[model samples]
Target: MRKGFLLAVALVAFLFPSGAGAAEKVWSNSVPDSVWSDGANWVPAGVPASVDHVVIGRSKTIVGITNAAFAGGLLLSPDVSLDIRAGHNLTLGSGDAAVNIELEGNAEIRTVGASALAFDAVNRLNLNVPSSARLKLGKMSAPAAVHQSGGIVQLTGTVTAAAGGTDWHVNGGLLYVKKNDAFSGNMTVKVAAGKEVQFEKGADAGASFDFSAGSSITSLDVADATSAVPALKLKALTGDVILKLINVPATLAPGDVLRVIDCDSPIPAAAQVRLDPASAAKYEIQLSGDRRSVMIGTRAVASADVVVFTPPTDTLASREYEPGVPFAASFDVTSSAGQALTVTTIPGSSLPVWLGYVVTPKGGASSDVTVTLSGTPDATVSGDIPLGFRASTATASADMTYTIVKKGSGGAPGPNPNPRPGQPGPLPRPNPGDPLLPDPNRKSRSGGGGCDAGLAGIVALLALLPLRSRRRK
Candidate 1:
């Protein structure tokens, strides 16, 4: 029986010697290059079968692979692109074999036996994963851009945006959403401290940027995104990084914050964090004491520092000053930090040009600045102009209004407009009419009402004369 089995094996080998072992196929090198699957385009004179090991060679353009599966391994080239058509599954890195492949095109490319895939070389991989396709990236250096022009990025293992200046753009599809489950690219990125990462919008319109719970990123840039709720709730655990929150809403869902925590960042301690209110107001950015996040609002809206965004009010409250007639307005400023505060006028603000103003005591609360329109103001200036000044240590600013009154329109020095509520009025001129609006006192025989009394007596005497004349006649 042994002799008969050996003879059968020998006969089978003699019948199909090449079929026993698989062949290696290389792309065609001749002019007028042919397609990848063409039988005449391979070095072995025939296209590779499912069992043959394949290596994609350099081409003027990308080559297409339309096969179900490969039993052997594949060696992909960095210079060339290999596209696996839809409905076809292409495998690489089998039996400890590996290749350097940068995924492009709109088809699916994944490993069959390999569990992990590491990408490298400052990848500009513009890969699209349709619902029928998924991606598996191993733990490695982050790519320049993980653009989801379309499709699912199946996280087989932890991925990291671990380098400097990395960008992850999302146009459509879910990035592994299953509640508070925090992972890289889902809600956070496992990046080195101070590494810059930008979250931006792409072709998919009406799509808002969403950052998950426990998000960790360094040097974030979300200036190009607009979110429905708090777009990012990342902990500054990544470091105290300077970030721009443009188009970010003031509050998310009534109380949620855009930035949840600011811890571990490399940002240094500052006496005050100055806010550019023009940009902040456009994006609705505000910060509360409870919420250390950048764009979050507090339960008490007034508790937050939104004075920068508030418009200027009447600084000279109820007080009117005429031009060339020196008058002063006092502003009592309070600081959040009891630290000594320094006050200065903001440049480009409505600073007094025609009117000379001086801030007194330059420090501490209950401080008053005297603004007097001592010079001749422009003839056209007659309304309230806003004067902006900021406190250094307190990080607070005031928008006070100054009225540039016409020459002498203000009534002659009446009672102070801002007098105390119960303060007494000016002394009255003794008269039966209104005590106010009384005639000025004159030095004559009688103080006042003497004219009325004398006039009444003369009128009575004149009436008596008319009666006496009539008796004599």
Candidate 2:
């Protein structure tokens, strides 16, 4: 009995199978109107529901959705098109199942009014807008990734991505986000060499792209064109963003300004918008005074001709310096056309401990500036000491080396020829008439009357004087 029951069950299962009732509903357009809710428009005689995969194979058939509808999947044949009429919506995927929508050979999906193609967060949407096809929508909530190889996708309304993240690839196409539209997603764009990704604004007043919801853009490609340069505006950058330049035209010239990004809010100090090295070499990148825009000017604008007025030398001793005397040397740097100039001490080229310096007009858009090196060297400092400095303008830079030399403690102290009132005077001169006192100015004789001889002579003279007095008496 058990074996008979098993055989009957297997026969029934084989006949029924799984998903055998699902059908691919092709558009036949048998009805008078293009209403998608009409049962006569789709072959197999009924409107497509959750169990049906909708295929628009007719080259120019326009299907209109009057109300909310569901489909297992949607596919547009080459040169075919699908339109979700205004005030209506069509949803792909039933329940938790995933839906795949492929557009091949210049097909398009255009939506109007409040109409939209909806997908559940649990549903994966595989949408391909490739090669001359277009996808224009007012609003779209992308639950899964959207891949575009070489077509255009214009969003005039908000497109929000699920928390799981969405990767948008614009391989060789244009993705234009219109003014004031908010596109929030963890989107990584990989644009081809000649492709473009633009975020535009109507009046440059409000934010063009809002990533404030923690959405991030890993990489973006911008074109090097005189017109239609890629510009983006953000409230704030909460993640790393990189800007790359593509399609560098051969007609690029000096002094040309390429406006790249515009933002309403100040970019965080820690957030850096980096450019590729090759592009950086060809252009001068700078932030606006408000720190809200990134501007790129041709290298020519920054390449001012810098002229150094101070002659180049290896020695800092421009003038003779006494050991304890103050020393000063000035170097003047100016740019062509009076462009701004900057003078600074080169890194690792600091002045000696005994020396100090100051740069006049510290830094600004000044045509000329001076760098003065001054110091007082004591007797202890001597010999040559290395010193270096760099002078630069927006486009030009020059480096110079000057050394300090300390002459020995200015020769020993010389006698003060003219003594001050309180200081000691030279020795007193001897009187010419006094035979007893020898003159210091003249050299002494070999046997001149010394101290003892002089005293004895005085005594003898006194004794003789007494003898003479007695004889006279």
Top-lDDT candidate index: 2
Q: Which stretches of candidate 2 lie over 4 Å from their true place?
A: 1-21, 30-33, 144-150, 163-174, 184-196, 201-230, 234-284, 288-293, 296-473
Candidate 1 residue-wise lDDT at 387: 54
| Candidate 1 residue-wise lDDT at 185 | 40
In angstroms, give how far residue 457 of model 1 lies from its true place.
Answer: 21
Which predicted model would earn the best TM-score? Answer: 2
TM-score of each model, in listed order: 0.34, 0.45
Kindly list the per-residue Cα lDDT of model 2 for residues 326-367, writing each as its tens digit.
888766666666666677777998877767887676356666
lDDT for each residue of candidate 1 in 158-212, tens digit (9 for 90 to 100)? 3445354445554444343211212344223323222233433221111122232
Q: What number of clashing residue pairs does each candidate have, in the order they appear?
A: 7, 3
